[model samples]
Target: MDGNKALIAYETKGGATEEAAQKIAEILRSKYQLEVDLVDLKEQKMPDLSQYRNLVIGGGVRAGRVYDKVLKFLENDLSGKRVAFFVSSAQAGTPGSYEKAKIKFVENTLAKYPKINPVATEAFGGRIKILGKTVTDNRDMVKVEAWAEELGKKFTQ
Candidate 1:
């Protein structure tokens, strides 16, 4: 839809997921001329879904599940909207456990979305820095970027 509004909400542990969110927002903006709202989940309110026709959420996956805010957003009434989710984690591999984890998250959400369904969903690999104050662990920018690009396409679609 022309002139449709898109919102991308994100929760970042060390900034990687925030980057992914921005990347997806950029993709949506560049290709569709849509207004994109990038919200930091930590500080923002619960979000009113009635304002926008399209929405995207990205957050860091720690331990297993992603940030709590993103999770809450998922439970909202999405109904007939176009929506997607992207996550950043240390488990990214060339079809390894991390990929499995993301896929599972996607599948489960999709299956459940019929109850509160969106138009689509996506998951992107995230990074962690092994030695930094604000970030540490395993940093995989390449993997994250690849997913971000793909996610961009998905959002546009």
Candidate 2:
């Protein structure tokens, strides 16, 4: 609700996207001294976009696409906002699949919202498990924190 505040709205099917959102929020709050609000998209309550100076929307990759709630949230008016986009996917950590993941998750979202120019767009590593067996565990806290720090610089400047 303050100009120095940031809102990180995320859509998560599992918990990887939520983990990324929390990491971003922690970085912004501790390192950048910004008040942050972490909102789950399924909560059904959207914050007033004009209230915060920074907005970060992210979600996990499902079937090679971002969550529908995330897409719907982006459909709102985002003019005059310092926005950032991030996505969590196992493909993000795979050398051969990283670019494709970025295209599918980040670039495609940009294509949909041509009017909104994000300050930063990132594709972070994510974890996935089936039947309690790890399929991939690529979630990297360092990368996520660095991206959030970059976002802090963008918002502050």
Sum up the clashes in candidate 1.
6
Backbone clash count, each prediction separately? 6, 0
RMSD of each: 3.4, 1.4
List lDDT for all candidates, in order. 0.66, 0.88
Candidate 1 segments whose C-alpha is farther than 4 A from its true place: 1-3, 93-95, 109-114, 130-157
The Cα error of candidate 2 at residue 12, in Å, is: 0.6
Single out the weakest 10-residue window by summed lDDT for candidate 1: 133-142
* lDDT: worst 10-residue window of model 2: 44-53
Per residue, candidate 2 scores C-alpha lDDT tens digits across 1-157 of: 4669899999997789898899889888888888898999998588777888889999888787889999998988888889999999889888788898998889987898898889899998888889878888988888888898899888778
